[model samples]
Target: MSIVQETPIYRFGDFTLDVTNRELRLGEKRLELNARYFDALALLVREHGRLVAKERFFEEVWADVVVSDSALTQGIKAIRRVLGDDAANPRFIQTVPRHGYRFIAGVSTVARDDTAPLPDGEAAGSPDAASTPATPAAGEAFPSPTRLADRGAAALATALATALAGTLGGAVAGLFGGLLYGFGLAHAPPDPQPGTASILLVLITLSGFLGTMGGFGVGAGIAAAEYAAGGRAAWRIAGAVLGGMLVGGSVKLLGVDAFNLLFGRTPAGITGGMEGAALGLAVGLGAHLGGGFEASPWWRPVAAAAATGAACGVLIVLAGGHLLGGSLDLLARSFAESRLQLDAIGHFFGEVRFGPTTRMVLAAIEGLLFASCVVGALVAARRPRNGLPA
Candidate 1:
């Protein structure tokens, strides 16, 4: 003969999971859930707040069986389906990246004695009159991917896109600035010499490298926002763009200020911080708004192009003043040897002249180049895959 007892119940929100009977109920109604899923949910609820590693899931849920990872994923998906939880925006379970899962909701426990029956007037199907239900927290909970490898791949692609954009932005700035410098030289009365041209080429290349770094900061911000806050398309894009601008601007202004403070000299000039902030702001806004598609489009080539172009344009304008200075040593050597015949070089060095007209021209050229390259790359990448919107 065997004696049966009422099981202990674990309560969270409106659901009560009875371990003794292996039943889960909402209010007075019982919900049909698979035993395996129930086991996984029970474990999650038990360890609430702490991440349950995948290895532990196998040991505890599958009893150390060499099961595929898909088993755990299916179990989790089933649990979410029953709970009406969104994996993109979870209300109960949160997936820990590269790890297992965590139960974020609060829980309480109740124990019942089966030996003692209820009072004559009490009903078994009614809500638990003896227990006080803890008030569940307001709003939906965050959800992440059950698979780490998938998210990791997305992260890598986002990172690569940002880096490439930054580098391209820098290259555009340098190339245009060099062109403007050469154009200004061409109109001068004296013909420019080889040494001056070589020096300017090196200076232009250096400018491109620096511009690339500045653009990279904005890219990082966009990626971080997307990964951290999963939201509606508008919210994600807005948040990402805003975050990118803030980060980009901060990178430019603060970096320059730091160098000035440390060196006891302002190498970027009095307006360097202002220039950096402007560049950062433009990059963020252009990149976020350029796509003009849904708030959260599957593809973002247009936006990338716009952002890269915007960043390149701003940097090229700000970097115009650096053209002649960068080539000073080479110019000096050439001048000493009488190898530089251009009177324009002498005037440029003496006056430290960089005109606004030239800067605007450079901006237009660099911006166009950046936009074309980024857009082309994005379109090409998407072409092979079918069903994507044009």
Candidate 2:
């Protein structure tokens, strides 16, 4: 029923992807490829040297459900890194921007039984290619899959911690906001629903996720692009900024359906809506970052997550209207009520209003998060393994 086992993976140029082994080999060395990216490779390699249109890539690879365009773009970037393919100055993969990618290489399929042991016997004929499998000099670094997995695991752990921390932190912040507004120390409510704090809690959590996903997604994109471009500052920075914006904005858009489903209707209260937006952002951001540091030393993911966590905190609070009044406050109340906190809790949250201060919150948080991402990305870009500085 599946081509995975029935159809053999073909080898081309110096690259080899053993579908049966679930491996991508370059000469005697197996390249480190994450599962999802590997899937993309398998797809392209199966039809080696052919043009894989962006639309087909989307329909075949990500046809599961509704999603934004960013995921496909990210996936292509990852594949190119592992394959040493460049979208520009095509060595292997040629990008027809606004269309698709074409893999242009000499494809030579080998009998699985004949070349299973050493990256397809004679597949790596170049002298330099042969050296990759040899023992590394004393302190030399090898980009092995095992090493990559270890790094990815560490990042996963940190991201989990940060996400949890953000959740708890947001809940606490929401609780206090409710208390403050309840003492009649805040603004008045426009309708009957859950409270402002309740709504903020949810949105803040979302914001944290988006911050995590966007921050880390960009960071990883920078890493991959660096791997391809040799860490040219201008190139990597361009990649990170563009990639981050695309992924981050896409994550925000994805929340539409979920919001409608969870709220049983378009959300109606103030505070409630803002909180939801924040939560979506935070969670997505966290996941994206976790993926970015997959090839770093085990500690890098934690560092990344921590960096993103800090950013998430700033964005979550600001993106909503807690620090200043904006549309965030206007919509937050509906979300607060959705949680169905006690009628009074809902009432109090609804009363928490936003106004002129909203712009200030946005400016401060935006500036801070932007600065953090820039610094973090630069650090990541400096370390060469893929496109980073050597």
Best by lDDT: 1
lDDT of 1 at 228: 50
Tell me the TM-score of each prediction against the true structure.
0.40, 0.39
lDDT of 2 by residue, 1-390 (tens): 744323444666667767667898887898887665676676665545567776556444433221223455666777788777777666666777767776555555455556653353445333333332222122113346665565456444433333333334333333433343333222334444446565555555544554445444454454444444432334444545555556545654555456777766543322223433332343234334544322234244334444554455456555543321232344455566434332232334342333234334342443334333433343343233223211
lDDT of all predictions, in order shown? Answer: 0.50, 0.46
Prediction 1 global C-alpha lDDT:
0.50
Candidate 2 off by > 4 Å: 1-5, 63-67, 116-176, 179-390
